[model samples]
Target: KLSKRYDCVVMEDLNMKGMSQALNFGKSVADNAWGMFTTFLRYKLEEQGKRLIKIDKWFPSSKTCSCCGQVKAELSLSERTFQCECGFTADRDHNASINIKREGLRLLA
Candidate 1:
């Protein structure tokens, strides 16, 4: 689905293996098959002139509220959910995905 809908993919530069040290956090992240997905996207996109963009690990995509554009002062790794001061609530990964998509688009344009 992601491949069909999007021309390119963008991801965070996370140390996925290190992330697994946390209880549920590490396991779930590893389960996402991010490395495999990125590899697949890279080869696939290259065939079509598309590409993948990688944002920095410290990009603050998760802590920055997409709606209000405010960067939270405190966002811990233990927090799997994002609670924005602006009342925007979203899953941590989802929120980061949104930010990544936005930033990736800006970079492409």
Candidate 2:
């Protein structure tokens, strides 16, 4: 249903180190499937005549505010949530995902 509605998918160049570090050993084993998921998603998207836009590694998707486009002074790995002065609030990961998607769209345009 979602695929039928959306024309494209976008993702960020995820920080493997951060992801790995955040997981417990047992969870890390499970998280190993992430790469496989990404590969499968890419092929599946192509088969559906859809494109995946991947944002660059250097793009500051996490630090940059998606709402007001303000840059935060600091954010740490321990921070699992984002609270911007502009009143933008989101889970840290979700915020990064949104920012990366925005950046990807900009790059595509």
Q: For candidate 2, lDDT tens digit of each residue in 38-75?
A: 78777777889987777777778888888898988789
Model 1 regions more than 4 Å off? 1-4, 21-36
Instruction: Estimate the lDDT of model 2.
Output: 0.78
CA lDDT of each candidate?
A: 0.83, 0.78
Return model 2's CA RMSD, one decimal: 2.9
Query: Each candidate: RMSD to true structure?
Result: 3.1, 2.9
Distance (Å) between predicted and true CA of 36, model 2? 1.6
lDDT of 2 at 84: 95
Candidate 1 C-alpha lDDT tens digits along 15-70:
78777775547568788897887788788877778777888888989889988889
CA displacement after TM-score superposition, residue 52 of candidate 1 (Å): 1.0
